[model samples]
Target: MESSSDTFGKDDSADAKLQESRVVTEEEWLQKWETNNIGFHNEQGHPLLKKYMDIFLDGRSGLKIFFPLCGKTIEMKWLADMGHQVVGVEISESALKDFFTEQKLSFSEEPIPGIPGKLLKSTTGNISLYCCSIFDFTSTITGKFDAIWDRGSLVAVNPCDRERLVTIAEIYALLMLRATLRPPFYVPDSEVKRLFGKSCDITCLEKVDGLAERPKKWGLDYFWEVLYMLVLK
Candidate 1:
């Protein structure tokens, strides 16, 4: 495993810039979805989620799972089908719509009062998606969840906003994320501890090099994805 400094160092300007670019505005994310530039999405859902299902469930069922920065991820459907209530917060309206349409799930949208967007709920009421900035979608709005699956959400967050986010997590949130570099895009173990250690007990469940074919796509010689489970104390 590379040191956090090695991952976050500015020695590679191109890599640094590429990672920095991921901290884009909500509009930019919306544009990415509109143009179908979502290579971050996994069509079959995340393999780790399946591989570690036992850990997440812990011999329990009827979990209320949460997904942050969810972009038409098929994982939500998978959990809902298993009789768990799935709640997700997404910035792109189109992404939310695509999730329902692609999953062939009947849903209804109701304007979320005081927000710029609406809440889309499946007809079965097992899955709920709120189209709004993640920062705006608070626990007060959606209540609590048994666990949070933060695949790409934390990595895409602006660094300046990270501390505030960590502070907010004091009230709610915990789990894993995907990042190529450290800090704004990639968060190494040290970064994870630095951000959440004070409020949560952090455990790194897994860390692996990116897929053999993905380095070229992300413009990096190597990319790493680390999955951590955080329990707020």
Candidate 2:
């Protein structure tokens, strides 16, 4: 893995300008959806996910995996095929509907108590998509996910809101604090403790490589990127 500083050294100025921009909100993201501007959605499972599924799953079955900013990706199908349950969160109902329609999967929707949105559950254990906001998610709705796979959620937000997203991520970690796995790098333990209100034993923390893949929409700087994974304990 390359040094974070080295990666940002020459691009610091460009990054600074980018950071000064406002983070996109649910409404803004929805606007993107209305215009069919979702270029980030992948037609297949993430390469890194396919490569490390064995290492992450480790023969475990019936595990629950969380997908934030799911964006109609078929990764959930891959996880479900492995005998794991998938809880996906997305802010755009349009995208979620497209996912179901495209997959030819019929689902029933139910209201999420105390939450503004509803849950969409497929008949099969293969996938469950939540049409809700990420910040408003709780264990009551999502239950506890065994492993969290954040392919694009963390880096999707503008730099200003990245910290807030991290805090939310820590809360998610705390919810599954007793899970069999923990997060690798990118998410700090201190932040996890702050959000979880307790210390977490993070087993199998490793910075694996080869996560960089993007469509033509992403700039050159983001063409090659690193992604982190965790198995909570």
State the local distance difference test value for candidate 1: 0.72
Every candidate's lDDT: 0.72, 0.61
Estimate candidate 2's RMSD in Å: 6.0
What would the TM-score be for candidate 2 when compared with the true structure?
Answer: 0.74
lDDT of 1 by residue, 1-233 (tens): 22233233454445544564345776777798999988788888888778777777777689888887788999899889888999988888899999999999999999887767789999999999998877776777877677777776667777667787666555665443333233236554556777777877766666666655645666656667766667777
Error of 1 at 86 (Å): 0.7
Candidate 1 clash pair list? 181-186, 182-186
Tens-digit per-residue lDDT, 137-186, candidate 2: 87766666666777766556554665676666665652221111111112
Q: Provide the TM-score for each candidate, comma-separated.
A: 0.85, 0.74
